[model samples]
Target chain A: MKELSVKELFEKKKKDFALSVITQPRTLNNTISEAQLNRPGMALAGYLDRFSYKRVQMLGETEISYLQTFSDDALYERLKEMFEYGIPCIFITKGLSVPHQMEYLANEMNIALISSRLTTEKLALNLSQYLRNYFAPKRSLHGTLVDVFGVGILITGSSGIGKSECALDLVERGHRLIADDLVKITLQNNTLMGTPARDAGWFMEIRGVGIVDIERMFGIQAVRLRKQIEVQVELMPWRDNMDYERIGLKNNWSSIHGVNIPVIYLPVSPGKNVSVIIEVISMNHILKTFGYDAAEAYTRRLKEEIKRQSRRNR
Target chain B: MQQKEITVTNKLGLHARPSALLVKTANNFRSELHIIMDDVEVNGKSIMGVMTLAAARGSRLVLQADGVDEDYLLEEIAKLFESNFSED
Candidate 1:
């Protein structure tokens, strides 16, 4: 199971959320196994049934005000009961002061008590967004991801098959390079988002030229941070007898992280401008998205012409 | 087809230079070669594909070759890995 320690969350979002450690700092190592945060209103009110102890608990203004009405001894008893469930940690939103009794029991129980200055709604919204992304499924692929006219094309092929060379050519023609060599893909909300490997930066390795920095050579406009992988273009060595895709009547799809992306196999050979072909593919893809398929339209016209010829013969 | 499981013993693993050497050796034969690591298989004759494996020291890889010269292809690839791609 993927778990994030409370220390990691605090360290990562300390500046963004205006967070601070309230209780014993030693308890910050508590692991948060769930991405959801819970408001322990019912538990604080002495109802423990169906309590989501696995999630990080949040105490907003409502819960804190409720505890404010109770005596210190009564508040300690109430908090002690809730902490017995082994909850991950608690966040006090709105920069609220941590009650003496609550902090005492939290330290006694070794559960982290954190405070954030953001409003309750804003804190919950931002924290949930971060948590969801932290738990997303990720994979790395050996290919070049580029943004071609707003369409993300992942260029993949064997080693020395000119994938990088083709991507560089596309960059020269005004397309943006997202990643080269290793593309880090994350599945977020059913979309396969492609980004560069953490260490790859904006570099491309050409067979003869070694390594070249794309951003430095082509400027900032020639590269992007991440893009949605809408299509895949696989370059293969051209063979004499290979029957390639002559008509685009059928689409080939590749599934990654349960998302299906359209794939195009293009054969590479001497003197073929693969980059230009990729641009055309991107434009055709955009046209298809707008309900215009050139191959299907051409086939329809051919069928009509054949019908006309048959009628004249009859 | 010929297959062999080899371990990457090179100190730096299969970085750019080692991957290049491995691909160069694999291309000497006419057989189709594939290197499988952790269920992800890639073309062995492609430098980028081999580098993508990122097989560090002590990583295990399965090398498979198919064609009339499959035996020779596997032998050559196995020798490269066994020698740590000629890196100390």
Candidate 2:
């Protein structure tokens, strides 16, 4: 529910975007709820049916040239209707001259009008990417995230369940550690990226062994700033009563912020090398992405052999 | 369990593309697929594992498959090796 004001965005991105305000300075206080930008070509062309008021509108060459077709009176009326919709801000790209009527109406309506030297495409791409991170939904998870064979695996379990210990083992094996203890995850472009929480210490606490700084201990190659999480590995206490998946014939998934990620459960018991298991899981994820499914292959072969046996008997 | 010994005839042995193709073809069954070369045995369904075999041209590998379609899986793998992973 956080809001970004026109003034903040302009001030933050001015250096990179070279943006200059064209309307009254106070109009920069207007806020936009959406992270996405819109080029309201249709709205400027007298089509207000799909006008979005909560978007940061951009005027490119096409829109500017189209507005030139109208007489001063017609332009004034059209722009008036458009600004009355309460658009958060307008950006004229490619250093285009803001039409006199447009600038006059922007000031009259108190809507912040801005100009940038970049083309519409470059500005839109940059602004959207920047805004996406600011507006993305995020959550902090109690887990360890590691990059195994280029796959991001989030290890989650109860406290003192050896999450950090397993991560250490993987790190020793050359996999990169992203975040230990507290993983801050965010959904970016449908991919879940995880980072270390600002408050959490860079070191991980191991019972009886104490804290270990992964970067200091393993050098720069063993730590990562952030990673796109591809799988979730949950460590559960082993129980004789529970039936764990032995064949991995069916896939399991966990959802965070509506993004579904593959999940695997590894039962923790004495002498079980959970770190190696996690590494295999990461490798398996890569294989699956390349259209290889060992479990499905087994089932398919089973069905084929069964059919062949029945045919031979007949 | 089904097992077969096949020599890698491809000009490039098992490089990235061939290893990927072999892994893809190996995963289409319900079985534990393994590629054995000398002292090492790696999961056939894993590209990294398969690459670890480092099977060069003319290197013989033991293709071991355990599950229902073990025979079909081995046969398909054999066909791929025979075709040199389709890289003439």
Candidate 3:
């Protein structure tokens, strides 16, 4: 149900895709409902069955060449046949000359006709990527995101549980901060990508320190535009009767937008070095990825030792 | 000082999670708590110490407490063992 207007797409990709409005309808209000683009070769060939009219039609070299085969009246008829449907817009790639009949139909039918200087394949790839991102599911998380040792760790906790302070400490230790206070998470292809909220500049609000611009203070190396959320670290105040994870044998996971992200429950108390632990966690995650599991290896060693000792006693 | 002999009834015994639960429960009271299993005795309020005992199922552990809340501490810890740490 997500829709994007042609004007917005043209305005956004005008420079990057080399897109130019060839023929603007009375209003550029036509909306693109489908993220996938379509090649109108089959429909232009007089076979409209299964034609996806709800997509942005692309007139590549082949489709344009096929249309060029017809005479003026025949080409007009062919273009009018496809334009009768509710096509959002049309893009002629490789900066192909927009056929006069096609432009006339586009303007008459209120479809935005655009031209891209890039090759057909390149334009399609870039445009599809943009459309996919535009339609991705998004949510905001109340926490800080930082890249510790190339691992994206989302530090979440209660409001005053030092999430920002820990992030600041990590930033001071040369790690990169992605976002603080509010992280905008987008789910794309089952992966959660974290970015700073649109209005949330590179500033963090520490409890006693007020707002500090991290970009200006720490330089460009200390901030990231976006990062894939690799792990989630939840910091909770240490409690007497609360059971914390003492061993890393069992992995904990938290689901965000149906994607399960590994979660670590870290207990915070007086004098506990959370930033150092998070750094270790990031390195440990890397180690695990490389097939070296310290806890599991130690447990296997302990089991073998226990067996050897029992055999000796017997 | 108060002491009681309790058996570890949980199927997984004193693993990481149960040890955490035992330590958390032991910390609730204002008492110096210790768990003695065979020749190894460990502080009941310390997760690492409690895990070191490695007390398996049906192992008899002696709970010793010394302080103002020793009796109440023993009672609460006994409840955790009776419930199998809420695990099957």
- Stronger candidate by DockQ (2 vs 3): 3
By summed lDDT, the worst window of 10 consecutive residues in model 1 chain A runs over A305-314
**Best model per TM-score:** 3
Recovered native contacts in candidate 1, as a fraction? 0.00
Task: Give candidate 1 misplaced runs (Cα > 4 Å).
Answer: A69-74, A240-243, B1-88
Instruction: Return the top candidate by DockQ.
Output: 3
TM-score of 3: 0.85
- Model 3, B1-88: lDDT tens digits are 9999998777666766777778877877899998997898899988768866666676789999999999999999999999999999
Question: Relative to the unseen true structure, what is the C-alpha lDDT of residue A301 in candidate 3, on a scale of 0 to 100?
Answer: 54
Model 3: residue A276 alpha-carbon error in angstroms: 2.0
Clashing residue pairs, backbone N/CA/C < 3 A, model 3: none
* TM-score: the better of candidates 1 and 2: 1
**Ten consecutive residues with minimal summed lDDT in candidate 3 chain A?**
A305-314
lDDT of 2 by residue, A247-266 (tens): 57567899998999989888
TM, every model: 0.74, 0.70, 0.85
Q: Per-residue error at A47 for model 2, in Å?
A: 3.9
lDDT of 2 at B36: 93
Question: Model 3 - which docking category?
Answer: incorrect
Alpha carbon lDDT at B82, candidate 3: 96
The CA lDDT at A101 in model 1 is 81
